[model samples]
Structure formats: structure tokens, C-alpha cells
Target: MPLTPIDPRLDPGVSAALAAVAEREVDQVFFVACGGSLSIMHPAKFMLDQHSAALPSDVLNAAEFVARAPKRLTKQSLVVLCSMTGTTKETVAATKFAQSAGALTLVLTTDPASPLAEAGDHAIGFEAPYTTGVPIDAKNSNYARIYQLVLGLAKIFDGSDKLGALMDSLEALQPAIDRAHTHFAPLFADYAPRLAKKDVIYTMASGADYGAAYSFAICVLMEMQWINSHAIHANEFFHGPFEVLDENASFVLFKGLDSTRPLTERAETFLHRFGATENILVLDAAELDLSGIDAGLAGNLVPLIFFDTLWRFAYKIADLRDQEMLEARRYMKKLHDY
Candidate 1:
């Protein structure tokens, strides 16, 4: 079935937030969040790194951002933070810390009434499956909002013209994701039994797609399913991690169309040659139908597309192991004191 098309328009709040940032002499960008929120910021930082020559950016964990207290974080800095519930203690503290430094802060969350939203200089609300059980199209996701904000900043600071093409791609993202889900469904089911037997699953990827692999390993596999997992950078896989790759080991490699794709392809080549063929599952973005997106920009959006598809695979493995994805948490939110 064809998924519902997303509206191509940016949220009005995004425009206003960009306008506010444009008024400042912003010198640097810091993406601050925790867990999956931090993962989504990786591609935004990568986008700015590729397109903006003068603006420097970094993705920082919320608690670390507050603790490290970089000297560069000042009135001239733009701090962007995301928390799905807008109530993450570390994130809220980071938002207040950024504001205390007189930095321009933009917070993305699902509610206007959230404490994180109330604390930021600007806030943009997004629809997400985490907050609402109903699945929203990718266009309205926190990743889309962050990407749009980064594209806007790139345009304002570096005079880049990629936002229009990106908006167009966002409109087509849902159908592409639908097609990918359809294609990967049976493959995931077939792989689930073998995957369930593994004690630890390693996820590998490079460039912008690395964040997706990281999130799947930590958030989905470890947090949700209570599986032992680690995410490895494909570029660094050759350094020392390859020694651990035997036929009994399992891995999920993500290959995207970005400049760092060759790095992952090298890892894939070695994985096959080492006789780990049956235990390795490769998810290549090149296999997805991205005709709706501009060729130059499609690679930049691959992480968003991969997230939608890999989420289904998470459920498949969880089902095979009789684990409850949502209700199985032991210490995530149950503890009062850390």
C-alpha cells in the first residue's frame, strides 16, 4: 500500500526560529540531546560540516554539554536541543545552561507545554511515534525538523540552496519508506530466528548512516530488547575490530550512498571473505527507491529512511525472542535516584 504523502511545508515556528537566529551573530552550532535524540543530530552536524565553510558544529550529549562547559558556548553560539517528552532532566538542564550563557537556544519536542520548550529561546513541536502511539510520516519527525533547521542555517550562513530540494524529498520520504518496509519485511522475518540465537549483535556503518546503526544498537537492541550489542564505525573496523569477526559472530551492516560508503563496502568485502556470510545481514540504501529525491540530496536523507525500516526489524527480533519492546524496560524510567 502507498503511504500517505507528507505536506512539504516547514512548520511556521521553524521559519520564526530561523529568523530569530538570523538576527544574531551566531558563530557556532551545538546539537545537544540524549540517546536517540543525540543520534538524530549526527546527520545535522554532518550536513553543516559539508555545506557551511565558516560555521563550526558539534553534537554533544546533554549531560556532557552541561558538565564540560566549553568556552566556545557563549552569546554567539546557537544551541539546538531535542527531547521527545520535553522532560528529560539532563536536556532541560542543558537548555537552562545554554540560556544562562546567553546562547540562542532552539528546543524541539512534542509538546508546547514541555519544560524544555518553555526554557528555550525558541521551540518547535513535532509529531512522533514515541509521544503518540500512532505513527507519523517522516516529514513531521524530529529528524526532519532538525534537518530543516540545519538547512535553513546553512542557507543563512553559507548561502546554500539545498533546503528546497530537501523539502521536496521530505514530501516523498513516506512512500519510499513504505516501499523499503515492504521489501525488508520477509527478509527480517527470515533473519530473526538466527539473530535471536546470537548473544551479541554488532552493527556497522559509516558517514551519516552511522547514527542509525548506533541508535539501533543502543536504543533498540540494548534498551528495548535487552540484547548485547555494539555499533562500530566501518572506517575504524579495519583497525582492530575485524579480529573478532568469526563465523559464529553476527553483524548488521548498513551501506549508504554518502561519500563514506566505500568505507562500509570495504568492511562488507572482508566480512564475506572471512566466511561470516550467513551471519552478516547488509542493509544498503542503494536498494531503496529514492527516485523522488534529488540524486545529490538523496544520500543525505538515507538515515531517516533507514530508521523507518530498521524499526520494523527491531520488532521482528523482539517478537522472536518473546521480548516486549515497550514494556520490558527495567531501569530506564523506573528509578528515582541514579
Candidate 2:
């Protein structure tokens, strides 16, 4: 069965909010949040960097952003703060900080009445039911909405209809991603038992997909399952971290269709040839049949689609290990005073 398109149901008020930002000539955009929400915005920052140079963008940790109050944030800046519950203390505080700094603020969250949402000048209530642990559906939906929203605003400002056309072509994205997950589900299920024995693992990727690598390593692998993992960029793999790689190393590599595909290829080649006892699992985006998607826009969408595959893989690993994803947290909410 095909999954429904999530973007079409976004509140109509969001369009007016985004359009208002464009009309005001927003010069800077800030993707601000904490934890997984912050990780979700990383690709959007990458997208903005690649497509819209006129709009300077940054992804900031909500607490750090509020504490360090950037001098450049002003009325012409747009801050996007997302929280699933919309009650995260730092994120809500960051929303207030951005507002105090006179920046145009938009909040994306499940609750419209939550502090973060109310603190912003405008908010888009996702209305998606939250899932336990990683919240795959919610995160993916937010990613789609954020990506489209950012591009839509850019299109309005640049007076180019390219993003609009690309979005139209992506109407079937939910199903395309679903298909990728179905294909990879069995592989992840089989790999989980072998992976559960390892005390630590290395996850690596490059380019736009680096966010996926980081999210899985930190959010799912480390936080959810209490496994020790490191996410390294392929381009930087040869740096200081290369010394840690040996025959006994365990690794998960993500390869995508972006320009940095060669970087991942090189890293994969080196690890395979040199690391004899290494347990290597490579997930190449090209393995997924993307014929249903537009060729021109495929490169941009592949990384996002690949993230869905990675999430399922991580979820399987956690389940196989008999770890309760939600109960693994010790310090996140346990020690709230920090």
C-alpha cells in the first residue's frame, strides 16, 4: 500500500507564514533545535547552502544558540525551531531568544499550544501522531515539510519555479521511501544479531547524507540502544580517525548519489581491502530503484530516502538486542537541571 503525501496536509497558514518571510526579504535562516530535531535540520542547511547562496543559513543547538546569541541574527533573519512535543526547554528558550533578537521565527511541532510553538511569531502544527523512541514517521514527515518549506521560500525570493516543479515531481516520495524500507528490511533483520555482539561500531558517510549517518549513530545507536558508535565523514575518514580502523573494526557505511559518492567508494575500498577481520555493512543508495522519481531531482532526494532505510536498520538492531529504545535514556530527562 502507498503512503499518503504528508506535505499536502500542512496547514494553509504555513504558506502565508513562509510567504511573509520571503516578502520581507529574509537574508539569513537559522535551523535551531535540540537533539534529533537539530539533526533533522542538517540536510536543510545543506540544501540551502547548495541552492540558495543568497540566503545564508546555519544549524544551531538550541541551548548553545541561546547562550551565545549571535550578533548577526536580526529582523531579517528567519529561525526555524522544531520540536515534536514543542515543550523542550532549550528549544522553547531558543524560540524566545530568537524572538527577543527580533528574528522572524517559525516553529514546527505536534502541539500548537506548547511553549516553543507559542513563543514563535508563527508556527506550523504537524498534527502527526508521535511514535515511541525514534519517531521515524514524524521525523520523515518533518524532513519533507522542512525541505519543501525552505525551497518554497527560496523559489518565492529567487522568482524561479524550479523548486515548485521539483516538488510536484516528488508527490510520490512517501511511497518511494516506503519501497526502499521494504527492500532493506530483511537485510537489517539478518544483520542485527551479528551486530549485537559488537561493543562499538563506526558509521560513516559524506555530503548531504552525513546527517543520516550522524542521526543513526547518535540518536538511534548511542542514545536509543546504549551502543557506542562514531559517525565519521568519508572525506575526513583518513584524518586522525583512520588510526582506529583495524581488522577487527565494525562499520556501517552509507553511500549516496551525490558528488561525494566517490569519497564513500574510496573509504569502502580501503576498509574492505585492508581491514580483514572488519565487519562491514555498506548501504548504497543506488541499490534502491529510484525509477519512479525524476532523474534531475534524484540526487537531492536519495540522501533523504536513504535515511529512512538507515532508521529501519537501526530499529531492527535495537529490537534484536532486546533493548527498550525509550527506556535506555538515563541522563536525557533523568537529570533535568543541566
Best candidate per lDDT, number? Answer: 1
Q: Model 2: residues >4 Å from true position, as ranges?
A: 1-13, 127-140, 276-278
Q: How does residue 311 of candidate 1 score in lDDT?
A: 86
TM-scores of the candidates are: 0.96, 0.88
lDDT of 1 by residue, 301-329 (tens): 88888888888888888888888888779
lDDT of each: 0.87, 0.75
TM-score of 2: 0.88
Q: In candidate 2, what are the lDDT values of residues 246-316, reduced to their tens digit?
A: 87788888888876789999999988976743378888888887765666556667766777677667667
Alpha carbon lDDT at 109, candidate 1 = 94
